[model samples]
Target: MYYGGYYGGVGGTWFLILMPALLLAMYAQLKVTSSFNKYLRVQSGSGYTGSEVARIILDRNGLHDVRIEQVGGNLTDHYDPRSKVIRLSRNVYNGHSVAAVSVAAHEVGHAIQHDEGYFPLILRNNIAPIASIGSRFVWILILLGLVISPFLIEVGILLYVAVVLFQVITLPVEFNASKRALYQLENGIVYRDELDSSKEVLNAAALTYVAATLVALGQLLRLLSIFGRRRD
Candidate 1:
């Protein structure tokens, strides 16, 4: 059997290794969406549009050169460190809800990270291009390794390790960004309940990163196990 050749005696163990991570990823995604939706409906007392909040945060940090622009999509906000631009989704660009502001602030947190040369952020950026290439071809390399050469499997495992490291580094960068967002929000933009709501939103969003890391770790474990079995 092809499975016998590739996976050895642990033919079906991929399911055992990956199912928990897959489920966690799904739950994290659902929680982020639910949290965002809940806060999106709750109007903030500040009555400031998301772009306005971004401007406030950036200006307060002496990031006057950074520009905020509207982007089309849901929960697609990001800071382009290369271009020195912050792009917010339409709901965030125009809406004055806690979710909108919190998300915008979280993105601006990335701008702050860039400006301050945050270590993990810098490391993640340095690894991104290689990780991107690894992500695209790692599976193919693994398949070839399984079919052709045990040495190729080792090579694939090393490449996959790089991808996993990138994800691991990303977790801190994301969580720190959320932390910066909440810190800024607490400086009088939102009151007690509103601050709590923003926290919930940012926390939920951060889980998505956690989920990605877990998924990568699980996949790496599975690959290692399969390789071990193949060697045996």
Candidate 2:
């Protein structure tokens, strides 16, 4: 595995395993997302724009307090937890394709989560600042540990703890988003049959999160393994 054999003192085996796994997940997400976007227009007979669809879903949920605004980029839609707003990218906000509706519905799902107090979402919000703090300094800290201290293990431990915590928090936030997206779709909050491609769009987008989490996890494991062998 790490065959580093105390080369850096840690197996780094986790990286050996993780890098390919990370690539595999990314490939799956990329293919799924691209294909869904490509084929969705064919099934999108609804002709309803993303902004219109967002309005419908929001009003249905009595979420008038939340506003939808158009932003730039492809598939860059997201719910702004801080401002309680939904920002839909150009494609997601205006297109009548399945990709549009599915992404729009998924963003609204976050507003619903905000309203209902989904525990994981709430916990994720609370941890945001803490995680941000760690991520911002993680690389510097890890590198500093390696170069500055004979007690490198302790420094590495700190870095690993921060990284792992960030990864752990990320998992639930994504899983909940996908759950809410599927729930909204199946509940007839958004009529996929009208476009018949909404499900695929949401499914594809969810895979992005899955890819991200797995990649983070693998990297964390590799870091841990690397530091873990320091005493050897």
Candidate 3:
């Protein structure tokens, strides 16, 4: 999830502070899109569809009960810890492309994290609802506080802190998942020569998470600065 919103007309130094992160976010989005599209057309040597690769990895890890389902949309693959199911986008589920398998394996990596009680994933899931609420209403509260009460602004800042925390926690989870995906793919599914391409896809994807964290952090700092100056 990306954290971003306008801070009314209040501008200057804080805006400058946020500029770099905003630019990085844009670059990250372009990088992931380009990498995914580029590799999506390049089929893996193993000829295993994304669903097939996910199934193999799941079963090998003794997660035979874990199920894989095809979902609609582009690059929407994810693992549902509650249902023990891996949901893949149509292309990733049926295509034999490097991008497809790499994405599929990355999602399976989440399932493995769930099974082993990975701390960051566990924490992330636990606070997901709070983070969701924070992301949805933080700006509203802050804007209202600007027009109404300092208390509301303080409350908004506190809520956004949760959103920022969630973004921070997500980094390790994604990085580890990509690492796991590389290991699984390298074993046999993806060719030796194709591994670098696979890494590119995963790394490009990881950059998005990094960008998100930076954006959240920058916004948090901006909020604090705004509040501080308001009191002055």
Candidate 4:
């Protein structure tokens, strides 16, 4: 998750800096949801279920050891690098719709990236633990600094820098996965006419990541502004 701290008492001008990013994040969520649902109702011409498409792509890439499993929740699909597993939501794993295959293939794209040690993906994985900690504790530290010690605010800012770095690093990883996914679908699974719709689905999903990065960046700017003003 590319989440950042919510500075509740910040000046209104600082809030203004974050508002546009928040709006984009909301729009991105709606776009992806609408695109996915609309295409989920439209069956793919190949008629292969999402799981089958995943298997085909994985085998073609010589990732025979990677496994697919069904998980609960809508749009909860992901590829776990540590476990070497691709988890799909029930609808994605069983559905034979255009959206289903597109998402399934996208997760397989991540698997292929992991197998080939894509630099961005590798860097993201390496820093994920620290970034996770930063996102979780950053606000707490900031709030405590306001009441206890200004030094804690500096520490909080350092932690938030890590969170922002993670979000920035994620952009390339996601965009590359979508690129790989589109290529795989165009080769055989998706029909020529259906390729555009598949691209729409993937593009909508990609917007969410872009929006997240923006939100993280906006929040970072707010934090820095406040810290600098306090010092002055």
**C-alpha TM-scores of all predictions:** 0.90, 0.82, 0.92, 0.93
On TM-score, the stronger of 1 and 4 is: 4
**Candidate scoring better on TM-score of 3 and 4:** 4
Best by TM-score: 4
TM-score of 4: 0.93
Model 4 lowest lDDT segment of ten: 1-10
The residue-by-residue lDDT of candidate 2 on 1-232, one tens digit each, is: 3433544533465677678778878787787768666855653555677777788878888999899999987767889978989999988787776677777777888888888888867877876666666656666666675666526545555655655566666666666766666666556544545434655666666666667666666766665664545434
For residue 147, what is the lDDT in candidate 4? 79
Task: Report the C-alpha displacement of residue 210, candidate 4, in angstroms.
Answer: 0.8
What is the lDDT, from 0 to 100, of the residue 215 in candidate 3? Answer: 88
Residue range 98-171, candidate 1, lDDT tens digits: 99999999999999999999999999999888888778887788888788887887888888888999999999
Tens-digit per-residue lDDT, 90-181, candidate 3:
99999999999999999999999999999999999988988898889988987887888778878988888899999999999999999999
Q: How do these models rank on TM-score, best leading?
A: 4, 3, 1, 2
Candidate 2 backbone collisions, by pair: none
Please identify model 3 stretches exceeding 4 Å from their true place: 1-13
Q: Estimate the overall C-alpha local distance difference test score of candidate 2.
A: 0.69
Q: Write the per-residue lDDT of candidate 4 for residues 48-163, one digit (tens) a residue.
A: 99999999999999999999999999999999999999999999999999999999999999999999999999999988988898899988988887778777878888888888
